[model samples]
Target: MPDPQSLDECVSIQQWLQREHLPLASPRPPAAVHVSLYCVGKSARIPEGVIAAARQAGTAIEACQFELVFDHIITFLLPQDNAIVLAGNGGRELWQLHVQIAIEMHRLGADANLNPNFQPHTTLLYDKDVVPRIALRRPVVLAAREFVLLHNRRGQADYEELGRWPLHARG
Candidate 1:
């Protein structure tokens, strides 16, 4: 997830979408902005074991803080609505972090359903209208110093952070 300031900048982009009269799929606060790393499945009630495994995965990964550069804006057509997002190259460091997390989750007997081909992005908003891909004049860069495990309450637009782990500087 992005730091607070970067999250605010993401929110500003969403605000721009609103000003342009685009019908927002939902109202999301700055805190909701995040690039998803793994999905731990969706159930009415999440088991304690699953949460434990996620935390364990967070602790197991040894990586340094990295930068995420979102250089373009694009729209993805979904079954429900079109999602406007900031797409970026998370680079090798990010990919390794993701892979390490997946490895740890699997080793801990958790079903993360890892995607082999992961394209990192942060969704700004969803709308019926499609926005053509546009390269930004200035790419939005986010310092990824930490990762958090969040329990998202579907339809409520609420995320409960369960655990947070900081990425230390590599020796």
Candidate 2:
């Protein structure tokens, strides 16, 4: 562990994981590279006001915020493919709050799709023959103040983020 960046060091760690019999997921495909505004909760129907807020927010960010470019693919297991319509980095506290919000929205019959355990990630590559061979290094904080509502295609369909909104500011 003294010099963790060496190739030998990296191979040793990979060997350890193999010896431990941990299940590693298959790598994703390169064609899957995409940008998205992950779905949030399903409220029987989206509220007109919420949709308006999202559109306004998208316009604001596009005008003022620097667009972020990413090279990762991520997935969150949800019951339905298109339930939630927004995604954001809530930090620890805000993420917790986001989950609670989804739960509450569900309890109130909001039809929102809530991830059981939401861990935000950006994918870098999809492996076709073998699973990715590297562990993720935590990324530096980036500007992501809002999540967007994406038009849901089928489970295997390509989703596009239509609009975004600012994260409710932390008090």
Predicted candidate 1 versus true structure: per-residue lDDT over 11-115, tens digit per residue: 877787667747555646677889877777679678999889988888888889889999888887888877788898989888888888888989999885678
TM-scores, one per candidate:
0.90, 0.39
Count of backbone collisions within predicted model 2:
14
Q: Write the per-residue lDDT of candidate 2 for residues 1-100, one digit (tens) a residue.
A: 0122322332333344334432343322223322332344344455665555444434443212222322222334444331111123434543453454
lDDT of 2: 0.38
Q: What is the lDDT of residue 59 in candidate 2?
A: 46
Which segments of candidate 1 are over 4 A away from where they belong? 21-25
In candidate 2, position 14 carries an lDDT of 34
Q: Highest TM-score: give the candidate number.
A: 1
lDDT of each: 0.82, 0.38
Q: Model 2, 146: alpha-carbon shift in Å? A: 1.3
Report how far residue 39 has shifted in candidate 1, in Å: 1.5
The reply for model 2, stretches above 4 Å from the true place, is: 1-90, 130-133, 136-138, 152-158, 168-171
